[model samples]
Target chain A: MTEEIIIAGFGGQGVLSMGKILAYSGIMQDQEVSWMPSYGPEMRGGTANVTVILSDERISSPYLKIVDTAIILNQQSMDKFEESVKPGGVLIYDPNGITAHPTRTDIKIYQIEGTKLASEMGNKKIFNMIILGGYLKVKPVVKLENVIEGLKKSISERYHNLIPLNVEAITMGMNNIVPYKIEKHVFQN
Target chain B: MSELKLMKGNEALAEAAIRAGVDGYFGYPITPQTEIIEYLMTERPELRTGMVVLQAESEIAAINMVYGAASTGKKAMTSSSSPGISLKLEGISYLAGAELPAVIVNVVRGGPGLGTIQPSQADYFQSVKGGGHGDYKLYVLAPASVQEMADFVEDAFDIAFKYLAPVLILSDGLIGQMMEKVILKPQKPRMTNEELIEKNGSWATTGKKGRERNIITSLDLQSEKMEARVHRLMKKYEQMEKEDLRFEKINCDDAEYLIVAYGSSARISQKAVELARAKGIKLGLLRPITLFPFPKQALFELADQVKGILSVELNAGQMVEDVRLSVEFKVPVEHFGRTGGIIHTPEEILEALEQKIIKNGSIRHHKTRKSSIL
Candidate 1:
């Protein structure tokens, strides 16, 4: 199976890192993967995004015009990538800080309060892990054990102690995802 | 030991150089490729293999330092973007004239002069047509993947040392920055001093004590002697064309239309070929692994099979001239590209092929594109 995806959000919210984790997980499973980031000034403070492709076969182009899924975290990303998701594909996003919600009927939409949940968990750094968890709940493209293994490989040994905490956030995100029902007022938290 | 790791192109090349037992690396930092030097600094290849990594004061200094290291038949390399590469052209010419084997990497950016920090293939003419001020040719290798980025290091050095020529890895910001899974090979120890003297003793500046001091100079006061030196260099390049030329063909058995590209453009055109095949179009892709060699013979043969050809590059149609020349205008040849750092998409490339080659219904015809922004 092949999954082409784009992860977009603010620069410091770990958008590129999330894509990197997915790439590492794919490689651990003996699959081909590529992670192409928006380099230069856009990566400093502007909206940062990465296009990641994982496939059973050799991948041809790292630059992509279409994707199977778009994990959007911010409103600007929601505006930008909502149309990039293919028909019958998935678009997952956090409802927090979003002014206008995704209204596409052709693609699957799911929401998780990643920012709020991270705040409630007393560590905002796990926000991306929660989003990754939510994406895994919908697609389950990568095994959780491999994701954890990939996480260990991505971060340094100093953060090994926090693996279990990040696992908790992931599990929380996986269990808390709700399919969008077109209800606008239900997710203002 | 071998390792399977995910790395950017620049990072993989640096690690591969260390694993290849490179003697020294001298380079100035530039965007999309600073990671080459940065990774070298952070990984501390010096500790593991005694390889020296230094940040030179400028691009010119870095190249001169590379020239010095190469004079002793040591494996030395330097990397930079476009404008910085321009600064090293004089030294590159010297390396060619003196017949030194050193690796020079240009992770090309959009440019006439510092045009953009993004990936571009605009340097095709400069790379293959001798960017330096001379009649010498560099063995230019264009890597399309991070794996090739890692793998071509040894190949470049081998080719360089074999012919006593300079080898250039003509990469772009795209490959330099993108991350992919690459299988790194096992480390090989560097050639010992005795081995170097034995292999390159006749030409290399080994020492003055043993034999009549081997004079190394590109300049000969006698015009006839200079002519002989140039002819000798020319024969080596011709040998490279006969022995080391490389290219790849994809889905060409029944192809009626062909796309010729290299580097990042090759990867993108591969995708476009697949997309067109899905729609029942018989399109194939020809990727030149070596830019300097040009793959002219392969293109000449393919020209007979395919009805038309499209040359897709990242610049304003530079390789198009070479493509037309290779085919001798036997079939229609067109160019589709986006300049100033904007990568042309597969859809646009396919559209160009249809409009310029197939739909136009001519063996050779020209029509100026009405819209340039698509």
Candidate 2:
């Protein structure tokens, strides 16, 4: 199955990094993945967003207007991406940041207080990790252990000690999910 | 020995140049191509092989420096993107006219003017069909990945020295910016001064001792002499066509449809081939490793077998003309192109193949058809 995702927020909210983590995780799993960032002036302290495609098959283009999943961490991101989610898609939203509601009725929206969870975890910067945790709970495209290992590998040596804290956040987030198996549709002839 | 390392295309090009025994590297800093010069600077100090790496003040100075270094019978190279490459055309034309051996790289970006710093294959016509004035040709190699980036540099230099002509490595920003695993083979050392003076010292400005001082000039005062020079260069190109043609054929034997592409477009076309194969369509790709040689004979042989050919490119049908020239009227050749420095997707290429080559829809007929062949 093709997994297309968009992780968008204001600059410095770790949107691009989140997308990179997902892309790297996909690559580690031996799947074809491409991470493309928005070009033009949006790259300079502006609204930074990244589109990531992870597929079992070869990816044609690294672009998509209708994403299967969207993780919105900020109000601007929620406002921008609310309309782009495909029918029967999944959206992970930050209730503490986004005030607007999704327009589509076919999507399953999961609103979380990411800011509160980050504060409780003793670091506000780990909010993106929390989002990833929630995303993995629903979709579980990659193993949680692989995502944490990728996170540790991507960071500097000085931050290597923080792996346990990140794992704690992922474990806490996963514990909150009530496991449900959705029938995944495959486009096969 | 081959060593595999993670490198961007620009870095791989620089490392390849060093491994290919390039005597000198002259270039200016341009986005996407900056790493080439950076790689030279980082690697130049530790080099026991005695190579010269200089960052010129501007693109013009860089190309002219290449011209000077090449005139000295030393293997010299330069690199830039589209705009910077445009600035080097005057020097390129001079090098081609003088029949000098140099390796030039154009890490292509969006263009016409100061286009965005993104990947683009818009300079296909300017590169393959002689970017300079008069009649000349460059040995062009389009590389899709960082692996090809390192591999093509050696091939380009070999072709340049064999014919005493300029060779160009045509890559794009995507290849330049993206990182991939590269396996670089152990490089042979540079030629000795005595050996260079012996081989190319005939026309190269070495020294005027017992032998006459040969002036390295492209200017021929008499019209017949200049015309004769052009014909000689043409003959060298024809010889290259017969001897130095390089291409990669993928499952083309008895295929119903064929896809013709190069560089990054060729990589995407490979994915299209896999996708089409899964759908039970017999598809193949002809990736031209040497753009100047065009692989005309191979394409002609395939034309008799396949029903049609789809020319896929990142620009608006520049290489399509070359494919049409090769096949002539034997099979219908159509084009699937994208302009404005945008890359075409494999799905888009597959769709084009399904609609044009498979369904047999008549696209724009090229006027240059049969003008070169039949």
Tens digit per residue, CA lDDT, model 1, B100-210: 999999999998887999889988888889889878999999999999999999999999999999999999999999999999999888878899899888888889676
Instruction: Report the lDDT tens digits of candidate 1 across residue range A44-103.
Output: 457999999999999998887778999998989999999989899999999888989998
Cα error, residue B101 of model 1, in Å, equals: 0.5
List of clashing residue pairs for candidate 1: none
Q: lDDT for every model?
A: 0.91, 0.81
Q: What is the interface RMSD of each candidate, in Å?
A: 0.8, 4.2
User: How do the residues B1-374 of candidate 2 rate in per-residue lDDT, one tens digit apiece?
Assistant: 78855456788888888887888899999876788999889887336567888989999999999999999888999999999999999999999999898999999988789987777888999998899898999988888777789998888888888888999999987777655556798987898888988988888887777799978878998999999999999999999888888899987875889999888788778878977999999999999988888999899999889888999888777888989999976888888977775667677889999998787533322333645455
Candidate 2 chain B: 10-residue stretch with minimal lDDT: B361-370
Colliding residue pairs in candidate 2: none
Assess each model's interface with DockQ, reporting 2 decimals per model: 0.79, 0.18
For model 1, what is the alpha-carbon lDDT of residue B158? 94
Stretches of candidate 1 exceeding 4 Å from the true structure: A183-189, B363-374
